[model samples]
Target: MKPVLLFLVSTAWTLTGAQYYYQGLMDYLENRLLAIEDRMQFWHEQSHRYHTELKDFKKLTTEAMDALSKEHSLLFKDLEGASVRVDRVEREMDYVESQTSPRACANKADKVVEQGAWGLEESRGEEEEEKDWEEVQSKVSDCVEILSGIRSVKILKRVGSPKGMWTRDPRSSKVYVFNGTSGDSIYQFNSVRDFSSSLGVSSSREIRLPSEFSGTGSSVYNGYLYYIQQEDETDVQVVRFDLMTGMVTDIAMFPVESHALVYSLNPETVADLAADNEGLWLLYAASDNEPNIHLAKMDPDTLDIEQIWDTRCPRENAEAAFVVCGTVYVVYNTRLASRSRVQCLFDVNDMIVSEEAPLLYFPRRYGAHASLKYNPEEKQLYGWDDGYQIIYRLTMKRKLLV
Candidate 1:
């Protein structure tokens, strides 16, 4: 009976130990499964975040590439423009070099001193002739006589509607007549000589402007047309027109006060534009004040006005103006039957008018509506009369203002 009791107690203890071991195994298994599930969820969230970041990076890359393309195109265009300017400068320098060559036999030795060796009789005759010429010049205060007269008259047949300022290109000698109403209405001489001869020989080419483009004062530089455009009477801006591409660009804007103060009364006013060796010039003529007219010289590239001067115009209205050899010549209506209109020269250095008046004056046919233009290449002045259909080629007779 003692042996039986001991065996039974031992079996009971062993069974209890086995039950605790099984319980601990089950708890370990459950904890490991929960940890594996949490890890899988963390991996899924990380993948989604990486995908979102990749999408944002791709979008930003595309935008940056687009900006770079635009920058490259602009840089290329600028380089091309620089090349064109350099070529033009080279051509100008070559022309100057060619023109500066000295002429042969231009300077002559004094014949009076060498006459004894050659022959005294021949020298005496030449001296008497020179004295006679000198006497005539002295009587006139050494006034240099310039032959002034109309060289030719031609009717500009191709001009559809000539209403505003006219100018001649210094390089090409092509005449451009502006029509403010339409760009298609702009007239250009196919051959200036043919058009000047009234032959109607060669047809003109039309420069079509955009519908929104409008201007009054016009000039050409390096094959580009420049003009002042007035949006309103008080709003003015400078525009550049490309002759080859028919592209119009706004370069600069004038002060509102400049427009408002000028041409206070006249609603339909004209602006004068002229160019010479000295650069570009602009004339603001119509004003109610004492010194009504204002003249300005503009920098070609910057559009900055370098000089400004005031003039009390002697005539009723200023039609055309040009700067040449450091002098400003103005054409205006004189309103006299004997002399309907006149061209007056003003010394730019001395902006002073002599009491004698009209430093150099010449009469013109009274065209009720006429315009004047000067061609530095031809050294000729062109006068166009819309009323009589007459365009006059005039040569100036100039004398020093005594």
Candidate 2:
């Protein structure tokens, strides 16, 4: 009986131990499952945030593209308006060319002769005859002469920028050299002889200007420096600066089409300031579409416009131009730099006929002229070609006018 009771006790103890082991394994699995569910819930929230950010970025990109499209539309409209203006200018130019034909000029000359004969019969006084003689002499002095040819070319010195201007004042012995298209300083030499030699910067006097110049179109006259000042992108102002006082004496705003360059070859020249026997002149293209150059007579002292003339000289291949007396001689060259020639001219005094105009060609030189400044007293053209300062001596003859 004792042996059977011991066996029953052993069997019950083994069963109790197996049941406790199974309960512990079940509790561990429940805790692991809870941790996994928490991780999945966090991942879902992060995915929602990423989706919202992507949508915001897409909205911003669309807004930027819309703004860019609007700007492009406005730019296209401006281009179209400019095109229309160009077409209108072309039509007006055609009409003017028809009127200035050779036949029309001949008819106008016949009427002028009849008027002159009628006036001769009515006039009878000595004073009137003296006045008539003086008038004839005055007219002859004002560009009744045309350029026969270029007599000689003297290369003074090679200095400064490859494209710059160096000239002597017609009224004085002072030589002024500008290094670039725009600058506030000017190199002044006492005489032409001094400029020809390599004196360096120490010997030359530097004149500091109050305002900066915009283009290569600057000239010295009667101890004053005249230059173009770009007030804005479109508006232009001519400033007359006194060399002695180093002050801006005068500023005159002139109408110029800055959209197109004055000289296509030398774009740095917005408006060329030229001096001749008749006084100061401004050469520029007024209309954006009109490639023809326009000439304006300006008062040296007051910077006032005396008169304006459309030279009808094409600006396509023109490099530089100079005024002799009252006639404009436009020098032209190829884009690759060839022998420059005076292909077109305009006489403000109406003394030169198209048929009688001389086609003067220049001797082959370094390159195109950056600027051609005429010295009335010396009767020479001070030109800046490539980097060489050159002087062109001109031979003149009486113009055969209608």
Candidate 3:
């Protein structure tokens, strides 16, 4: 019994010591947790501060974009008004020039029609005058002089419908004509030969289409049409209409207030699409609020889209008026009065043939986008001048027939 009593004393001492030790450990742990909490609070404050700064920067960017967009809109309106006034001036010029030119160049058949046959003859006495006029049209160095008159007419019309409206793919064909108003009309055209023909052109059955959002542009691809629909007062939605499937899907939405970015949105994945045989290329640029350029290659078969390139112009003054072969030509105006720039020879590898160096340049945009087009089949290019849209044969005169 005495031995057991001694054991109890030792056990009691050990337990008492252990209790104090545990209390000390608990206090240490509590203090450590408090310190950790304080550090976390500091980090949270810093994080909130950075987030605030980021938001401010984004707000500034948005404001800048908004101001630019509004300013550009006003500028376009003024330009349009000026363009109308120029039309009157052109009328006066026409009245003056009409008094002369009793005989001029021949027609498409190389036979004289309006000008008469005798006027087409090469006169030795007037050879120098004819030679000079022809030289201005043919020589590369003379493009500016030839295009000078054209620039005056175009600077005013740049605000209206594209003077250089062109289709990229050659597969387009004339479908049935429909009578409808622009904004109130919903029009659908089919590219299919058989399906479209099945719907008789003179039929009484009427299909009504709705007006798509206007401010955003539209594109036509193989078997599909894509455009942006204004979702609300604050957002825009990208929608695609598949001709084969007869399905409409909203692929992406850009909220004007919450988010502002520029990227490509297509119905199907086109990552594997190579630029060589693909059909229908669509290029769009938005400069004012969102300074972005999108280059998309669309597949004719599956209504698929492949976005190959994206570029940013924060200042929002550049416009890619036209694309030929694999090159993109941009016309830009700086903030400085009457100073403009042409960004040419742009090559985006994914947009066209890979490993190719595309040489392109701004021809002359007296005050607006330059109008130039290239025809691969004919190996020719066309440029619009004041009163004439002139054709240029890119291939040498010797090998043109090929």
Candidate 4:
């Protein structure tokens, strides 16, 4: 019985020890699983934060690229504008240089016999030329008057091109309108009242010219129309058309320097034809190299160049010019539009000195004038500014001679 009890005791001890060891092993495995779960949760949170930061960075970069593109486009436009301005300036400079060179002046002197029969030296003997000039100057001082200022402005019907001309004949009540710089059509009105009426050319007569005129320098005197026609590349033909017959009465071909325009500011006007109290005058530049304006006295009947005079008025910055009596008033302005002013003057009789000439400024109207036609009969200036037809009433005073 003692032996059997010993055996049972030993077996019980061994079973209890095996159960404790199994429990310890299970605890160790559960602790290890819990640690692994905590590590996985920490890693998941870190990955989510990194993704959000990357998305925000991508959005900021896109916005920056869009802003830079807009700036680049604006910069390109500004550069283009600057380039255009620079090109214009360069062209003007080249034109000026070609006109003022010594070679051009020499060529002009060799070709032209400036003093014709009408010149002071040829009109009288060389010995009496000084006396003749003084006498003519005295007569001019007595009869001719200086322009004081513009008294009134009447904006008549706004017609045709921004560069055109309209004038009433000094002898008759007839009004003539030459539309664009180059056209074969001319409109005529019976009277100034008819032109001013709002009928809008319904009462006007459209007379087609035989040939197309080249420039805006055209005029009507008595019953005839005188205009410049381009005859080939370097020559201009002055055509005289009879209003009554509607036929070309005479044509005179005159040589010009080049295709360069007479007025730098007004590129459309190659020459300026003006009628004053002294008769029909042709205002032109001798050559592209000559900066001064030249005046020629033309006989309305013969289409002959009677005399030529160097006006000494610069062609640079000149927009339009008109002759009052025997004096030429050159109106000047900037390329960028400004108040027009009579900056230069030339008198055939040498009655008025340029230094003492009145400072004449046109009332600031619509842009610069494309044409200024003086009517000695009404004592007014018919002007084309932009597209408006303006009439300037004059106030004259006895010229202050020096």
Backbone Cα, N, C clashes tallied per candidate? 0, 0, 3, 1
Model 4, span 1-402: residue lDDT tens:
999999999999999999999888899888888889888888888888888888998889888889989988998988899978866765555355333311101111121122322233344566676765455445453335556667677998787788888888899999988877888998999988888884666569999999998777898888889998885777778899998999999998776754667799988777888998778999998888898989999998988999899999999999999998788889999998877888788878665556555456776678999889998888999998997889999876554222
In model 4, the runs with Cα more than 4 Å from the true position are 1-143, 399-402
In candidate 1, stretches whose alpha carbon ends up further than 4 angstroms from where it belongs are 1-158, 162-166, 180-185, 194-203, 211-216, 256-267, 285-290, 314-316, 334-338, 351-366, 387-402
Task: Mark the regions of model 3 whose C-alpha exceeds 4 Å error after superposition.
Answer: 1-169, 175-208, 233-235, 242-308, 312-315, 321-327, 334-345, 350-402
lDDT of 2 by residue, 301-369 (tens): 999998898998888989999898788889999999977877787777665544455456666689888
lDDT of 1 by residue, 262-320 (tens): 33222244455666656677766444443455677777667787877664453345544
Winner on lDDT (3 vs 4): 4
lDDT of each: 0.53, 0.78, 0.39, 0.78
Candidate 2 residue pairs in clash (backbone atoms < 3 Å): none
- RMSD values, in order shown: 24.5, 13.7, 21.3, 14.3
Query: Candidates ranked by TM-score, best first?
Result: 4, 2, 1, 3
TM-score comparison, 1 vs 4, better candidate: 4
Q: Who is ahead in lDDT, 1 or 2? A: 2
